[model samples]
Structures are given as structure tokens and as C-alpha cells.
Target chain A: MRATTIHAPGDIRVSEVPDPTITAPTDAIVKVTAGCICGSDLWPYRGENPITEGDTIGHECVGVVEEVGSEVHSFKPGDFVVVPFCHSDNTCAHCLHGAHSVCTNLGMTVSGQAEYALVTQAEGSLVKLDEMPDASMIPSLLALSDVMPTGWHAAVCAGVPEGGTVVVVGDGAVGLCGVLAASVMGAEKVIVMSRHEPRQRIATAFGATHVVAARGREGAAEVKEITDGVGADAVLECVGTDAAMGTAFAVARPGSMVGFVGVPHGVQLPVQKMFQKNVGLRGGMAPVRRYLPELLDLVTSGSIEPGLVFDSTLPLDQVADGYRAMDERRAIKVMLDLQG
Target chain B: MRATTIHAPGDIRVSEVPDPTITAPTDAIVKVTAGCICGSDLWPYRGENPITEGDTIGHECVGVVEEVGSEVHSFKPGDFVVVPFCHSDNTCAHCLHGAHSVCTNLGMTVSGQAEYALVTQAEGSLVKLDEMPDASMIPSLLALSDVMPTGWHAAVCAGVPEGGTVVVVGDGAVGLCGVLAASVMGAEKVIVMSRHEPRQRIATAFGATHVVAARGREGAAEVKEITDGVGADAVLECVGTDAAMGTAFAVARPGSMVGFVGVPHGVQLPVQKMFQKNVGLRGGMAPVRRYLPELLDLVTSGSIEPGLVFDSTLPLDQVADGYRAMDERRAIKVMLDLQG
Candidate 1:
């Protein structure tokens, strides 16, 4: 089997690797059908986060259950499924409360970026589709594996409501998808803060009523101006930079929520300002496991095609080019076809 | 009228001042019946927060309406009432959403530790009791003016649930009151981190199931062990210090909530850790205006007595001693009697 490995920063390479097998009773062997380069993956790829040499790299995927251990239940051979980013027992108090991202048993059961990955707590982490999805539904189904549900969680965490003003801070696939989610959730005004013309247009197409190109304080001021000085009812901080976090905090009105999805880099929460303004912050990794079903239904019903975020696609062997394109800002998201 | 003014960091003096008249159509002048020192007041008194010399102090008071403005509808002359620390019109969208603490109309009204306090947005910021209470209920009613509701909001923001374990991170009157609120809200285990004997006993009486005297990581470890390594489901941060904030974050289970009511003093939030842990931070000055009615009901029905926090009382002429007692840690809270 061939897998992508990062020897160091800027040193991603495709190399032959031993196939993964079930190491735990709750583990399942999954043959990756499709995978993609996630924005979070770049955190390690760019060396911003520590990554060991030859570490397995992806956490988003649609796969087929090739085999399952004795303890695995609710899944079987030849089943098509979407794997949540975090593996959980599905029975812990936290998982029961629908916070699967912080699952207690988060061992590397399965990773989406590889051709074959071991999935832990198979019954709890795998969401089997009613049937094998049609070829046309591949992109959207793959999205449900992470991006769509993540965007949805960001919107949900921010408490975006019907007819409320929501500000999305980022132009990446997840941020663009948040615009769609806010719209689906009935926000009357979804503003995407993006300077890139192409991404801004995509944001508008995804139901952003307004677009502000400013960054930090300037961006927040723009949002306030649009909202008559009350700031946004909710803010989705899709980018984890300090500037993006500051903008999110500045733009939220008192008693409003800020949902942060970006893997925080080096951001410090402005606690004093946040408390004084009565602003609340709730968010972390996308609880994709909890939101996949509803988002999948939306995708199947044709109300949204979030897979549009994939501006380019490549064969699994060409994953390096995909990374380069994204790092260079040439693509919003790079979809990889494992079966190709 | 007499007002308590801060002449310096450690100097509080009761001085005769011009009587306040209705400055806005929504304002009302109240003859203060009682006022108390708040934990927040210590911020400037301790020289941690800068304040201008001769600045009027205090934000908690219970009083009788002396005069009502033409636009004041809910309050009239001679009505006994509890004034919300924040003066809000209650007509703005933020207020309608129950964020009276961030009301758009009021510009940060204060001046509570005085002979008379002017309340703006009388209809929204003043809560009237069914009748004038006997002198015994004064301390409890005064608690409702700030500390009691603030503590309740801390628990509420932390999302304390029935049978859940809650940890309170302060030992001041508000933190002590949080123990009572947590028990009242049905939390089976309320852990209070206190080393002070009086406060520890008060916390136990108020229903703290566990008490840990350690601070920082050691304290968090103790709390974690008590909850079977899952940490507390909710943490109430009633002390606005870096150490208290750290304890709140350290002792919280992943995906749990932390409600911090203490005005932040040099506390910084580590967003990276917070994001990975999936913790949520919510709190501000308790929207006492929102919780006062329900708490007053509990008081009127004899269900709870929050007055236990006031360990000392003084006449209005001895207001300077009240400040000194609180500042010197000789008293948890000092109530000022106007009639004396």
C-alpha cells in the first residue's frame, strides 16, 4: 500500500507503507475510497505543529469496511461509510452528549488520508450510508466525512439563528461552507469576510448577504457599520489566527456567540474584553460525527452542494500537487480520488 | 445627598454631594435603603484597576424610589426596589435577548454606595418586591442586588445540571453563593476550593459536597480524582484572578462549561488548550436584572436565604469602615444601613 508521509516541514512524499490492520477488538479495517487534504493537516505539514517523520496524515474520508474485529458492531463487510475525524466508543458520557470530537477513546483507530486505515470503536465512529452512494454523490459524501459537518458545527456553536446577522471569518472551504450552513439555519444575513475575489463570489453564491474584505479591527468595524453599531449576532471564527480570533471577538454583540473551528495557532483569548461584553466562546474540532446525518440529508436533497468547495481534484498519487496548490492559494480544497 | 467616593487606592470617604435629579426621561431618583461592597469593588480599591480620584464608587443597592421621571412607568415614589448594577432601557434587541448587562441605552451607571442612587431605565433595571420587607430580609435582598445573582449566573453559565459535579473557584461571597446556587440548581456534588475556615464552613453550609484547599494544577488534579478523572461537569470561576481562571480551565472536563463572573484581572485565556479541550467560557457581571425576579421569588417564598454572605454590617456614617473591613479581609461582605 502507498501512503503520504511527512518527513519534515515541506517534505511530504508518497511512499510504500505496510497496510493497517485491526490492533484492537473495537477496530475495523477500512479501504479508503476517497480522501482529501484538510486545512488542519496543513498545520503539521507546514511544521507549525510538531509532526514525527513518516506519521500518517489524514483524518477525513469515505471508505468501505473491508473487515471488522469481534467487538465491532453496527458495521459489516462491503458497507460504505463516512468516518468521523475523532474515534469514540459512542457510549461515554461525552459521546452520548454529542461531543464526539473530545471522545475519551480517541486512539488512532482509522485515518482517512491512507489507502488502508484501522478504525477504532468501529460501531461508534462509522456512519454507514443507507446504501452505497452513487458516483455523483462521492464528493458530497466525502465532505460529510469532515468539512460540511465541521462548517455546520461552527454555525451551530455560534448560535446563528433565523434572521440573525452572522459573520464568517475566513475564505477557506470550511468558512465558505459555514456561510451555507448559516443560510440553511435561517440566518437572514450571512457575511463572509474575504479579500479574494473568486472566494468572495463563491461566498455570495453560498448565501452570504454581504462580504467585507477588511481584516482585524477594520473588519469588525465594517461588520458593526452594517449591523447599525450592534455588531454581529454571531461570529464564526473559521481561521485560527490571532487576528481572526480578535476580529471574531470584536464583531460579536454582547450575549452573542463566537464559534471557533480553526485549529488555534498561538491565539490568546481576550478574556477581559469578552467578559465585559458578555460574549461567549464555544467551539473546537468539528463534531462531524454528530452532524453528518443532517448535512448528508441536505446534500442528498439538493438544497446545497458543499462539494463545490473542491475547486480541483487529483488522483491519490498526485497528492503532492494538491498540497502545493492549496499552500499556494490556487485551490480552495483539493479532493483526492483513492479509487482512481 | 451623600456618596461614597474613592480618593485613592486605599481611601474611600463618604462625602456630601449634590442630590441627583432625573437626567433622562427614563431615570428615577431612589433614596438608598441599603448598599453593599462587591468583590469587583476591590479591583480599584486594591489598586489593581485604575480609577480617577474622587470617582463615585459602588454598583449594588436596594432603595426606595424618591422621585420618578415622566417616562418611568414601573417605578414610583416610595416604592422599595432592588436596582440592577447595569441600567438598561430593556427595549433594545440585546435587552430583549436578555443581555441587560450590555443594554445599549445606559452608559455604565454606578454610584450605589450612597445616600441616594439614580437609576436610569427604571422600568427595566429596578425590581420591586411585593411589599416592604422586614429588616431581617434586607441583607438577602441586598445580595440580590449583585452577589447572589452573579453567583447564580456563574453556575447557570457553566451549565450545571442535575446530579452533575460543579467546582467553584473563588471563596468570596460570590463563590460562597455559587455553592448555594449549585445546590439549589440540583447539582449533587458542589466542590469549593477554599482555604479560609469561615468561607469553607459557609460553603459547606451552602451545600458544597467537597472542599479542596490547594490551588492550580494540584487543585485540578484533586477535583479530577473526585470525579473519577473526568473532572467537573461545570466550573464556576468567581474570583477574577489568573490563578482562579487557571483552576477553572484545569478542572473542567473536556466539552464542559466554565462560567466566570469575577471581573477579569490579568487573566488570559489560552485558546490553544481551550480549543483542544472543547471547553466553553461564558459569564460577565451577572445579568442580575434578568435573574432578580426568580431569586426574589425564592427569597419571598423562604426557600433560600442568601444573606449569610453578609458577615458584618455598619451604619451609613461608618461606610469607610465597611470598605476597610472588606479590604482587610476582616469581613466577607459589609452591609451599610441607611436609616442608622
Candidate 2:
């Protein structure tokens, strides 16, 4: 089997690797149908996150179950499914509360950026599609595996009230998807903070009512101006930098929320500022699994096309190009066709 | 009129001051019935928060309406009321959203520690009592002015689910009040972290099911042990120090909330740790005015006696003694009898 492996920073390659097989009684073998490069993937690609020796990459994928262990009761071979980024037992105290992202029984699992990946806790992590989606639906469906659900989580955790104003920070794939999520969640005014024309267009298409090209204090001023100087009711922060976090807090109205999904890096919360503003901070590694079922329904019903975030796609052998495109900001997201 | 004034850090005096009068159309002059020294007041007394020359120091009190400006229609002379620590106009966007603490039209008002205080935004900041109550209800009603509402804000903002486990950090007046709030809100297990015997006794009386005497790491371990290795479902951080904040985060389960109300001082959030734990942080200055109505009802109905937090009482002329006692930790709270 071939898989994406990171031997060093900026050194990504599709190389021959041993195929994954069912090991635990609750494990299942999945043949990857599609996969994508994630913003998190760039952490290691940029050498920010050190790569372990021969580490397989990717945590997002749409796959078909090829084999299941004895204890896998929720899925069977040949079932097309959305593989959640995090594996859970579905019965742990945390998982029972719909926090599958922090499942207590979560253990090591195979990477999805491969021809065949082993999925642990299959019953809890795999959301089977009614049937194999059309090739065109593949990208959108694959988004359900991570980005789409993550964006939805951001909106939910931010407590984006119906018909309220929402501010989305970042122009990455997740930020674009967050615009869609805020719209679907009934935000009357959706504002996307973007400096690039292409990302701004995508944001508008996804239901952003306003776009502010300014960064930092100026960006916050624009949001305030748009919201009548009161700031946004909900601010979704998709970039983990300290600047983005500061902007999120600054543009949120008193009593509003700043839901941040970016993996925070060197972000120190200005405690006094947050306290004075009375802004609520809530977000983390989104409980993606909790939103998969509903998000899949939205995709299946043709209500939302989150796959629009994927501006580029490539075959497995051309995986390095996918990384380069995303790393260089040439693509919001890069979808990989595993079967190619 | 007489008032408590701070000439310098640690320099508190009860001296004659100009009598307060309604200056703004929305202002009301209140003759204080009972006022109290707060944990926050100790900040200036200990030189942590510098005291400006002749600064009148106090924000918590229950008083009787002495005069009302032309626009002050909420109450007339002789009406008893609870003065929330914050002065709000009640018509600002933030106030409309139940965030009275950050009201836009907020103005400078005389401190409650004075014999006669000018209450700004009277309609929004004053919660009028039905009528004068027994002498015993004075302290409890005074608690509603700040401490009780602040504690309730912590539990409410933390989203303490019914029958869930709650951990209250700090064992001061507000922390003890938090145990009562969490219990009233239906938490089955209300654990208070306290090392002092008096505080522990007050905590248990206020509905604490368990008391952890350890601080920092050991305190967190004790909470974990009590909850069967899983942290509490909600944690109310009532202390502003970094150590208390760290313990609050440590004792909260993944996907749980930590509501903080202590005025944060030199506290930096460990962003990475918070992200990995999936813990939600939401808190700030308590919207005391917003919670006053409900909390007052509880106090009136004898459902909660938050006033029990006041362990000492002194006359207005003995204001210096009240400050001294609280600063030396001789009392959790000190009530000032203006009439005496």
C-alpha cells in the first residue's frame, strides 16, 4: 500500500508502506476513498511540529470498510463512511456527553492518508453513508470527516444565536466553512476577515454578508463599524496565532462569545481585557464526531456544499503538490483522489 | 455625611465627606442601610491595587432611597434597594443582553461604603426590595449587592448541569457563596477547596459535599480522586491568582467549563494545555445587576443565606477596623452598620 510519509520537515512523499489490518476486536480495516491535507498538517510541513521517524500523515478521510473485527457491530465490509478524526469508544463518560474528541479509550490508530488504514473503535468513529456517494460528492463528503464538522463545532460552541451577527477570522478552508456554518446556523450578518481576493470570493459565496480586508485593530474596527460599533455577536477564530486570538476578542461584543478552533500557538489570553469585555471564550479540538451525522444529512440533502473549500485536487502520487499548494496559500484545501 | 476613604495603600479612615446628591437625571441618592468590605477591597488595602488619594472604597451595599432625580422613576424616597456593584443605564446594548456590568452609559458614582451614596443609572443598578425587612435580613440582603451575585454568576456561566459534580476554587466569602449557588442550581456534589477551618465549616454549611484541604496540584488530585479519576463537570474559579486558575483548569474534565469571577491578576492562560484538554473558559466581572432579581428572591424566600459570609460587623466610624480585620484574614467579610 502507498501512504503519505513525512521523513523530515517539508519532505512529504507517497511511498510504499505496509497495509493496515484489523488488530483489536473493535477495529476495522478501511480502504481510503479520498483524503486531504489539513491545516494541522502544515504544522509539521513547516517544521513547527517535528516529524517522528517515518510518521504517516493525515487525519481526515472518506473511506469504505473492507474488513471488520469480531466486535465491530455498527459497520460491515463495503460500507462507505465518513471517518471521524478522533476515535472513541462511544461509551466513555466523555463520549456519552457527545465529547468524542476527548474519548477516554482513544488509542493509537493508522493514518488515513493511505490506501488502507486501520480504524479503531469503528462503531463510534465511522458514520456510514446510505450508499456510495457520486464522485462529485466525494470531496464534500470527505469534508464531513473533519473540516465541515469542525466549522460547525465552532459555530455551536460560540453560541451563535439565531439571527445574530457572526465574525469569522482567517481565510483558510476551515474559516470559509465557518462562514457557511454561521449562515446555516441562522446568523443574520456573516462577516469574513480576509486579505486575499480569491478567499474573499469563496467567503462571499459561502454567505458572508461583509468582508474586511484589514488585519488586527483595523479589522476589529471594520467589524465594529459593520455591527453599529457594538462588535459581533459571535466571533469564530480559525487561526491560532496570538494576533488572530486578540482580534477575535476585540471584535466580539460584550456578552458575546469568541469560539476559537485553531490549534493555539503562543497565544496568551489578555485576562483583564477579556474580563472587562465579558466575552466568553470556548473552543478546542472541536467535537467533530458529534456533528458528523447532522452535517452528513445537510450534505446528502444538498443543503450545503462544504466541498467548495477544496480549490485543488490531486492524485495520490502527486501528494507533495497538494502540500505545496496549501503551504503556499494557492489552495484553500487540497483533496486527494486515493483511487487514482 | 461620613465615608470610608483610602489616603494611601493600608491607610483607611472613616471621616466626614460631602453629602451625595442626585447629579444626573438618572441618578438617585441612597442612604446606606448596610454595607460590607469585599475581598476585592483588600486588593487596595494590601497595596496590590493602588489607592488614589482620598478614594472612597466600597461597591457593595443595601440601602434606602433618600432622593431621586427627575428621570429616576424606578423608586422614590424610603424605598429599600440592593445597589449592584456596577452602575449601568439598563438601556445599553450590553445591558439589554443581560450584561449590565459593562453598560455603555456607565458613569462615576459614590462608593456604597459612604453614609449617603449617589447611585448612577438608578433604574438599572438598583433592585428595590418589597419593603424593609427584619434586622437579621440586612446582612443577607447586603450580600446580594455583590458577593452573592458574583458567586451565582460563576456557577451560571460555568453551565453547571443538574446533578453534575462541581468544584469551587477558593474558600473566601465568594467561594462559600459559590457552593450555595451550585447546590441551589442542582449540582449533586459540590466540592469546595479550602484549608482554613472557619472557611471549611462555612463551605459545608453552604452545601459543600466535600472539602479538599490541599492547594495546587494536590488539591486537583484530591478532586480527581473524589470524582473517580474523572474531573468535576464544572469548576467555579473564585480566586484570581495563577495557582488557583491552574488548579481550576486541572480539576475540570475535558469538555467541561471553568467559570472565573475573581478579578484576574497576573494570570496567563496555558493555551496549549487548555486546547488539548478541550476545556472551555468563560468568565469575567460578574453581571451582578442581572442576577440580583433572582438572587434577591432566593434570599427573601430563605432558600439561601449568602449573608452568612459576613463574619464580622462594625459601625461606620470603625470602618478602619473592618478593613483591618478583612486584610488580616480575621473575617471572611465585614459588615458596616451605618446607623451605628
Candidate 3:
């Protein structure tokens, strides 16, 4: 089985790896149909995060069930399924509160960008599609595995009200998906802060009413101007950098909250500003598993087209190129065609 | 008129000062019947907060309307009123969102412990009682101006669910009031982290189901043990110190939020922990004016006795002693009897 592995910074390769086997009673094997690169994956590729040589990477996938352990009752061979990046029992106290990311029996669905991926907590981690779908539906369904639900978490935490204005910081795939989430939630004005033209186009298509192309202080000022100095009703901080966090708080209206989904890296929150403005901070690792069911329905029902975030698609052998394209910002999201 | 003044960290005096006159069309004068020292006031009295020499202090009071500027219509002479510590129009965009503290035209109610105090934004800052009440009601109504509403803010931000467990991180007047608030909101278990026996008694009276006399790490361990390791459903961070904030987050359940109302002073938030736990931080200065009506009704209707938090009552001339008692922790709260 061909899988994506990282040797070091700037080194992503597709190499033959051993096929996955059910390792536990609750495990299931997934023959991945398609998987995509996430902005978060860039951390290791850029050497910002330590990574071991030859370690398989990837945590998002849509696939056909190849096999299952005896305890896996919800899924079986030949079924199409979407896998949450993190697996959970979905019955723990945390999961019951829709915080599956913090579930007591949590497991990571790693090595997903491959021919075969082993999934633990199969019944709770994998969402079985009602029927096998055509090629076109796979991309959007695959999105439900991580980005879509993560974006939805940001919107939910920000408490984006209907007919309210929202400012989305960052223009990566997740940020673009955040725009789509805000739109689907009925946000009247989805203001996006993006300096990139290609990402801006996707943002507009996803329901951004305005775009602030400037970065840093000027960008926040622009948003403030657009909002008539009242600041945004809510802010979606999709980038985890300090500047992005600063902009998110700067543009948040009094009593509004900043829904942060980006994995924070050296980000120092402006706590005093948040207190004074009554702007709250909520969101961490998204409970994507809990949100997968609803988002899967939306994608399958054609009410949303989150798959448009994927600007580049390649064969499984070109997984290295996918990582490079994503790292170079040449692609918003790079989908690896694992079936090939 | 004589008002409490702060000359330095340990120096407080009630000195003769010029009577306040209508400085704005929105101003009103009140003859204070009762005013109480707040825990926050101890910040400057203890020299933690910067204070100017002979600066007038005090922000909580219940009084009879003495005079009103032409534009002050909501309150009039002879009517008893509870004045929020901060004044606002209550008609600004922020105020309409129930965030009076962020009102566009906000002002502070200084010199509140004096015989007569001038209030700005009278229509928005002063809540008139239906009628004058006996001396017994003065202390409780005075509590509404700050402590009660501030505590309520903490509970509201924490989203205290009915029948849920709530942990209050302070034993001060505000934290005691927080126990009262969590009780009124129907929390099944209200836990207070208080080592002081007197404050613990007040907490019990206000509806604390359990009292964790331990502080720091041990206190958190006790709370975890009490909750069977699940943690509290909501946490009210009534103390602004980093240690208190640490405990608030340490014992908060996943998907819970920490409501903070103590004015943050050099408190660095544990942002990483907040994200990892799926716990949220919300709340700042309490919008006491917006909550005044509901709390006023609760106090006037004889449903809660927050006034019991005041352990010592002193005459107006003894304002300095009131500050000293509070600074020494000899009194939970000190009431200045202005009518004397």
C-alpha cells in the first residue's frame, strides 16, 4: 500500500507501506478513496513541529470499508464511509456533551492518506453513507472528515447569529470553509480577511460579502471601518498565529466572541482587550466527530459544496507533490486520489 | 459633604469636600442612605492599583434622589434608587445588547459614600425603587449596585445550567454573591473555594452545597474528588488572581466555560490549557445596570439576602475604618451608614 511519509522538513514522499490490519476488537480497515492535505499538516512539513523520519501522516479520509473486527457492528465490508480525524466512543461524558475531541476513549485516525487505513472505535469514528456515491460526491464527503466540521465548530463557538455580521480571519482551506459555515448559518455579512486572490475567490463563492486584503493593523482598521466602528458581531479566527489572533480580537464587537479553530503556535491572547470588550474566546480541537453526522447530511443533500475548497487533485503516487503544492500555497487544498 | 478619599495604599480618610453640582444635563444628585465597600476597592486601599492622592472613592450605594438635571427623567427627587457603579445611557448599541458597561457614554459613580453623590446618565445608571423601604432593606439594595450584579455576570457567562454543578473560585463578597446567583439559577451543587470560616458561613447561607477549604492544587484535587473526577459543569472565577483562574480552569468540565468578573490584574490566562480542555473563557466587567431590575425585584421580593455579606456596619465618618477592616480581612464587607 502506498502511503504519505515525512523524512524531514521539505521532504514528503509516497512510499510502499504495509497494508493496515484490524488491531483491536473495535477496529476496521478502510481502503481510502480520497484524502486531502490540511493547513495543519504544514507545521511538520515546515519543520515548525518535530516529526520522525518515515512516519506515516494524514488524518482525513473517505473510503470503502475493507474489513472489520468482530466488535465493529456499525460498519462492514464494501460500505462507503467518512472518517473523523480523531475517533471516539461518542458515549463518554465529554462526547455526550458534543465534545468528542475530549472523549474518554479517544483515538487518532492516522496514516489516512494511504491505500489502507486502520480505524479504531469504528462505529463511533466512521460515518456510513446511505449509499455508494459517484466520484463527484467523494470530495465533499471527504471534507466532512475534518475541515468542514472544524469550520463549523468555529462558527458555533462564535455564536454567529442569524442576520448578524461575522469576520473570518485567515483564508486557508479551513478559513474558506468557515466562510461557507457562516453563510449556511445565515450570517448577513461574512467579512473575510485575505490577502491572496485565489483564496478570496473561494471565499466569495462560499458566501463572503466583503474581503479585507490588508494584513495586520491596517486590516483590522479596514474591518472596523466596514463595520462602522462597531466591530464585527462575531469573529472566526482560522489562523493560529499571533497576528491573526490580534486581528480577530481587534475586530470583535462588544459582547461578541472569537471562535478560534487554528492550532495556536506561540499565540499570546490579548486577555485584557477581551475582558474590556466583553469578547469571549472559545474553541480548541474541534469536536469534528460529533458534528460529522449533520455536516455529512448537508454535503450529501447538496445544500453545501465544501469540496470546492480542493483546488488541486492528484494520484496517490503524487502525494509528495500535494504536500509541496499546499506548502507553497499554490493549492488551497490538495486532494490525493488514493484509489489510483 | 464628606466622602471617602484614598491618599495612599494604607491611608483612607473621610474629609470635607465641595458638594457636587449638575455638571451635565444627564446628571442627578442622590442623598445616600447606604453605601458599602467592595472587594475591588481594597485593590487601591492595599496599593495594588494606582490611586491619586485624595481621590474620591466608593461605587456602591442605595440612596434617595436629591436632585436631577433637566434631562434626567427616569429618576426624580424623593424616589429611592440603586445606582450602578458605572453610568451609561442604556440606549447605546452596546447597552441595547444588555452590555451597559460598554455603553458609548459610560461614566463612573465616584464619591458614592458621601452624603450626596452626583450620577451621570441618570436615566440609564439609576434604577428607582417603587417606594422607599425601611433601614433593613438598605444594605441589600446597596449590594445590587455592584456585588450582586457582578456575581450574576459570572454565573451568566459561565452558562450555569439548571441542576448542573457550579464552582466559585473566590470567597469574597462577590464570590459569596456568586454562590447566591448559582443557587437562584437552579444549580444542584454550588461549591465555594473558601478557607475563611466566616466567608464559608455566608457561602452556605447563599446556597453552597459544598465548601472546599483547601486552596491551590489541593483545592482542585478536592473538587475533582467531589465531582467524581468529572469536574464542575460551570466555573465562576470571582477572584482575579492567576491562582484563582488556575483553579477555575483546573476543575472545569470539558465543554464548560469559566465566567470571570474579578478585574484582572497581571493575570496571564492559560490559553493552551483552555484550548486543550474545550473550556471557554467569557466575561469581564459586569453590566450591573442591565441586571439591576431583575436583581432589584429578587431582593425587594425577599427571595435573596445578599446583604448578609456585610459583616460590619460603620457610620459615614468612619469610612477609613471600613476600608481598614476590609483591608485586614476583619470584615467580609463594610457598610457606610451615610444617613447617620
Higher-ranked by TM-score: 2 or 3: 3
Poorest 10 consecutive residues by lDDT, candidate 2 chain B: B105-114
Greater-TM-score candidate between 1 and 2? 2
Best by DockQ: 2
Question: lDDT by residue for model 2 over B1-340, one digit each (tens)?
Answer: 7889999888998878888776789989889988888898888888898668897888888889999999988799999998887888888898988878888976534577888888888887888877898899999999988889889989988899899999999999999989999999999999999999999998998999999999888889999999998899999999999889999999999888899999998898877877877788888888887887788889999989988899898988888988888888888899998878
lDDT of 2: 0.88
DockQ of all models, two decimals each: 0.73, 0.81, 0.78
Q: What are the per-residue Cα lDDT tens digits for candidate 2 across A92-117?
A: 88888777788887743457788887
Per-residue CA lDDT of model 3 for A1-340, tens digit only, reads 8888889998988888888887799899998999888899999999999999998999999899999999888888999999999898888888988888988888887788888888888887888987898899888998998999989999999999999999999999899999999999999999999989999999999999999999888998999899888888989999999989999999998888999999999999787887888889999988988888789889888999999999999998888888888888888999988766
Q: Give one clash count per candidate, in the order shown.
A: 3, 0, 0
1 against 2, candidate with superior DockQ: 2
Cα TM-score of candidate 3: 0.99
In the range A1-340, model 1's lDDT, one tens digit per residue, is 8887778887777878888877778989889898888887788778899988887677778889999999887899999988777777778867777778878886543356678877887888888877888888888888887788878888988889899999999999999989999999999999999999889988988999999998877888899999988889899999889889999989998888899898888888888788888899989987677787787788888888888888898887888888888888888998888988
Which has the greatest lDDT? 3
Kindly report the interface RMSD of candidate 1, rounded to 1 decimal. Answer: 1.2
Q: Which portions of model 3 miss their true places by more than 4 Å?
A: none
